[model samples]
Structures are given as structure tokens and as C-alpha cells.
Target: MQITVNAQPHEITSNTLDAALIELGFASPAVATAVNGAFVARGKRAETPLAEGDRLEVLAPMQGG
Candidate 1:
């Protein structure tokens, strides 16, 4: 399926958010996810379904001084 991650187009084979994260090598606790402008809880990633043209955002925590 084709989806946009952090404003970049990517072709992924996973059907769920969790699966996609793992497939994309983003299986990290510091990462945050949002689908189609809505935030998805970490626990819900496994159940969150993704579709074509969906906008998925993967954000990592930023540390500042």
C-alpha cells in the first residue's frame, strides 16, 4: 500500500500501523505516531488500520538543552 510518512511518500506492505513501523525500522519507544492528522496511542497501533493515500506521521522525541 502507498502511504505518506512524515510528508514523504512510501510504499509499505504492512496493513497495520505497528506492522508498518516494524517494517520501516521505526519500532522504537521514543517514536510517536499519527494517522490522518489524528494521534494514535501506542497501544492502539496494532489495531489501527491503514489505507492507501493515508497520511502517517512518525515523530521522534527531541531533546533540547
Candidate 2:
């Protein structure tokens, strides 16, 4: 399926958010995720379904403040 990841077009095989994160090379549990402008919790990522054309935002914590 085709979806937008971090404002960029990406193709993934997983149907759920968690799996898609792995497929997109974001396996770390520290990252935050939001789908279509809505925040998805870590526990809910496995149940959150993703569809084509959905906007996915992945944010990793930054250091050095």
C-alpha cells in the first residue's frame, strides 16, 4: 500500500501501524507516531489500521538541547 510517511511517499506491506513502522525501518519503541493528524499510542500501534493515502508522521526524540 502507498502512504505518506513524514511528508514523503512510501510503500509498505504491513496493514497495521506497528508493522508498518518496522517495514519503514523504525523499529525503535522510543519513536512517536501519528496517523492522519491523530496521535497513536505505543500500545495501540498494533491495532491501528493503515490505509492507502493515509498521512503518517513518525518523530524520534532529539537530544542536545
Q: Give lDDT tens digits, candidate 1, residues 1-65.
A: 99999999999999999999999889787789999999999999999999999999999998998
Task: Look at candidate 1 and give me any clashing residue pairs.
Answer: none
TM-scores for the candidates: 0.94, 0.97
lDDT of each: 0.95, 0.97
Which candidate has the top score in TM-score? 2
Q: Best candidate, lDDT-wise?
A: 2
> What TM-score would you give candidate 1 relative to the actual structure?
0.94
lDDT of 2 by residue, 1-65 (tens): 99999999998999999999999999899999999999999999999999999999999999996
In model 1, where is the ten-residue run with the lowest total lDDT? 23-32
Candidate 1: residue 46 lDDT (0-100): 96
